[model samples]
Target: MTVENTLELEHLEHPDHDVVVAGGGPVGLMLACELRLGGARVAVLERRTDIDPTLKAGGINQTTAEALYRRGLLPRAAEAQERRLAEYREALAALGGGRLTVPPKFAGHFAGIPLSAELLDAADPAFDGAGPAGEVGAVLQQDVERILGERAEELGVDVRRGVELTGFDAGADAVEAYTSAGRLRTGWLVGCDGGRSLVRKHAGFAFPGTDPEITGRQAVAEMTGTEGLRYGWNRTEHGTYAFGPMPGRFLTVEFDGPPADREAPVTREELEESLRRVSGADVRIQAVHSATRFTDNARQADRYRAGRVLLAGDAAHVHSPFGGQGLNLGIGDAMNLGWKLAAVVRGEAPDALLDTYTAERHPLGAWVLRWTRAQIALMRTDPHAGALREIVAELMETVTATTFLVKKISGVWHRYDLPGPGHPLTGRSAPDLALADGTRLADHLHGGRGLLLDLAGDAAVTDPARGYAARVDTRTVPAASPEETAALLVRPDGVVAWATDEPADAKGLEEALSTWFGAAA
Candidate 1:
């Protein structure tokens, strides 16, 4: 069934918006777009009037790539990927690549160690029936934000720029948010406002985790006498440093604890000193273009929701920028929460559906923290850490180890624990299947509604969704393997809610529909 474009048709006592998002970054904008697609009224309150042009998160993992693909924005993502690759090539050409060594097949890195693309198993089960989104895409953070922000505008999301969310009071019915612009009423509030989230703080969520033990600095500058630095990531005796993946981009990690003042300006002298300390190359900085400071200070909210308030992205969890998992993880959170929240607001599903957000995402968030912490362990400047790093590096050269690590780094191996599974595909991401109509399964899901695919080609298989015609769409898909899966019930976020290898069972299908899409008509 097709959804209407109408908005804000709730009762008279309904709040001004269904949801008020506290940040207008990529994750926030993505969530707003998802909410709008699910037919919810959403408003994004952003503090910055202009997009920050800082160089951060130069690529997205496979999971995030798939999310964009399912949303019909794959072409834009492809353009962004091509642009990033062209820029990388141009930068390398300017560097005059003669003696400088770089990895031949760079897929990704783990704690500065290169994970080769050649080592990945092409026949991995994770790639079975996967589409173009199974691969990673190189796109900057600002580029991702720009893409999502434009999509949000087109979707009719009310984005208020230069207006910060100061505080809010969450009541039983709705949340009254006090913003820099003024007070507003929203049924729910989500904190996507980065690490220093006022919504998370005002909601009194317990944020507990490890403190910073390293100060990391990244800069793009014009410099002279920098031939001594390595082309890619390098572990030095003092700290770690990487150069030239992008023209003058330089990064240094020092184990001298966190910075004294995180908000302090990054000067050319400071960057030059860091390069010397890590590379011992005596390089001189000619001009600084863009620079930023970071730390490995990791923390996670004890719970993601409090009453009518919730958190996502950096507001929900934060860690070191070691593997570039922050943005991908946040995108995953938005994709997971957006549909459920919208359903609850529309009174289609009970509020209990929202509880599953914490149950499913908290474990993944904890795992990311552990993943980054392990990298920190391998990055320390101690002799023991050096020995461990050497052993790990040797192991990483093997195909088995590289394949395992790449899967983790690419974010393609995640599987949720949904209730009452029927097939192995249950609770996993639904693969993009080639439909009989020459379209793909992802094409049917662009509207942000649940999907019931009748692989058995039986009319009875589509009957369970009759009660939920508005919330779930039914399709007759040409099953690639009827022996493996005869029917599939997919959530709006692309997660498989239920699957059946045997013939389609109406009882099981109805249970899944009621579980995820509320009581049947």
Candidate 2:
């Protein structure tokens, strides 16, 4: 059924979208774009009337940074970074110096602990500093939403704002979902609707986990009598409160239990009260800016997939935003789910292939849950926890100790234990193999097809790929170095599904392709 451009009519004549995504936030927008890339007709139903420009997520993390780059959106993101960097440099130069000392680059932080550039560099080996200067650091959540929303529209995703998922009735093969505006019919309904996901609840996916012990708030607001309040992460006897680099932006975490009313809109006045509570400061508020609240209310759906309804991003799991991992984690889900669901929707793959989405991503989500929990444990207000925090801080100060945090936070620490493990690169991000013509591996993924980096120069690999030529992008670039690699089959998500340093393994190659891109018939 063809969905029309008109968003609001009495009903949708074409309710048969390949997928109906609930939520217009970053994750949902990204998933919509990915589904579109996979040749699946999608209608993104967002309840929000407008795209939020709130700096809700501070920046994009490593894997997401790579995912955006693979999709050819990195230049735009780099523009944001470059714009900020230039402004920062200019601001510094105006302060008068013989040679303007370069400002300290924002080298990312874990929990509230900052990691050094050296630690960050050693965390992800794949980052060769070729694309987008800096250590694959921050990109505003607002920028991500804008880029993804535009891409989704360009790919013909029927995005309907002010439409929300009220409930879903799952069928054997399709889903009938009720929304605030009307009902939507689709082969699949993915809830990227965020932590308070109605789809997850209505679908009866067991979402069992711990609730919030501490409430966290971050805001860009004005204040008065701010003297003596240092601008940085300040761990006080009461709890943790900090001032952002910019004077207006402030962050505070209080262990006064979760807010009395979670739905209560965070305000600048409330922010000052919390600041005074945590920092014991005589800070006064002069003006108001955007403010928000969060908590370490970590929870994960027992099952991410249930019948025709599936969940991703915050719908699948929720954790503390300590490491800035929520956006990155959600994008990771979008990246992993896009092509698989696309293949299923196109009838190129079996339904069983969709099962891998849960199998692969569930453990990763569980790990992130524990990661947040551990950080929370270390951030206790008591002396015992303070001692532990001190130990952890000392560890973070050391390059070797900090690498662990950097790797996990950067997404280099986890590798999918995919079938047919030949080399370490298998189930990892495909190496940025530079071709003699200066083409990089990520360049081939702009079309959202599977890629086989045939560095072995073996003609045998091309034969298997021919059967799935439409889905698999097979490229045999001359190996830049002898010991670089032999051959690799990369998934659309930039994951190396199969790799071999020897002559092409026809049987193994076929298995990988058939399992991923579907049977070679």
Best by TM-score: 1
The superposed Cα distance between candidate 1 and the true structure at residue 281, in angstroms, equals 0.8
TM-score of 2: 0.93
Alpha-carbon runs more than 4 Å astray in model 2: 1-13, 86-103, 118-135, 504-507
> Residue by residue across 202-305, what tens digits does model 1's lDDT show?
99999999999999999999988777777789998899999866678899999999999898999889999999999999699999999989999899999999
Summarize candidate 2's per-residue lDDT along 44-147 as a digit string, tens digits. Answer: 88877777755488677768878888898888888776676676566556645323355365555655666776664443464442344235565678878888
Q: Where does candidate 1 have its weakest 10-residue lDDT segment?
A: 1-10
Error of 1 at 423 (Å): 1.5
Query: What is the alpha-carbon lDDT of model 1 when measured against the actual structure?
Result: 0.87
Report every candidate's CA lDDT.
Answer: 0.87, 0.80
Model 1 deviation from native, Cα RMSD in Å: 4.5
Of the candidates shown, which would achieve the greatest lDDT relative to the real structure? 1
